[model samples]
Target: NLVPLLVPLFVSAFRRADELAMAMEARCYRGGYNRTKMRQAVITTADKVAYLLMILFLAGSIASRFIHILV
Candidate 1:
């Protein structure tokens, strides 16, 4: 019963995908051809420090959740 309904749905999805691909090809879309970013992405020393601090904080949180403090 469900298979009959799903066959058309699958065909419709594939048809739409094919149509989109054709349209994109017709427009000469080369998928990231000549793509340029306005500002170049760079990871500086400060970014590295921030990432290290984030990792330490996450590790601290996980340790606190699993480790019990003994006084």
Candidate 2:
């Protein structure tokens, strides 16, 4: 019953695991390497705006749910 529902998720995870293993072997990575990003991965203005929107939406949903439960 629920087994079928989990099949896709399991398959996706297995595929990701296989890809990760291949990546590790390709790099001969024994452990975490301290590498620097060529491009600065800074939070730009757009990212800040998007994050603010996400926070607002999450807060609104939580507040609404709390009010609903209380009522």
Candidate 3:
């Protein structure tokens, strides 16, 4: 009962996917060559400060656990 209905749905989905792929190929979407390289992100002073804070927080969390065990 269900197999007959599901077969056509899958066939149509595959056909649509083929059409979309052809359209993208025509538009050079992620195609080989001539693509510009993305700019690299520079770490600013704020980023460095955030990283320092995160490291400090992690160290404090671990130290607190050890201190609890000692006490």
Candidate 4:
């Protein structure tokens, strides 16, 4: 029942992807050096704090898993 539904859904997705690729190709979008950022990326103090917090959170997560396993 679901297989019959999924086949057409997948076919439509692939067809749309092909169309998008063709449009991007026509516009000469090759990525890498061809791309330019509208705004320059600058790391601020807030960004540094956020990154530090994320790292601490991940480390705590991994440590918790190990602690759980050991106990």
Best by TM-score: 3
lDDT of 1 by residue, 1-71 (tens): 99999999999999999999999899888867787668988999999999999999999998887776631
Per-prediction TM-score? 0.46, 0.46, 0.52, 0.50
Off by over 4 Å in 1: 36-71
lDDT of 4 by residue, 1-71 (tens): 89999999999999999999999999988888658779988999999999999999999999999999999
lDDT of 3: 0.96
- Per-residue lDDT tens digits for candidate 3, residues 1-71, read 99999999999999999999999989879865778889999999999999999999999999999999999
Task: State the weakest 10-residue window (summed lDDT) of model 4.
Answer: 28-37
Report the candidate with higher TM-score, 1 versus 3: 3
Candidate 4 clashing pairs?
none
lDDT of 2 by residue, 1-71 (tens): 98998999999999999999999899887764776558867998999999999999999999999999999
lDDT at 55, model 2: 100
Clashing pairs in 3: none
**Winner of 3 and 4 under TM-score:** 3
- Superior by lDDT: candidate 1 or candidate 2: 2
List per-prediction Cα lDDT, in the order shown. 0.92, 0.92, 0.96, 0.96
Candidate 4 wrongly placed segments (more than 4 Å): 38-71
Report residue 27 deviation for candidate 3 (angstroms). 11
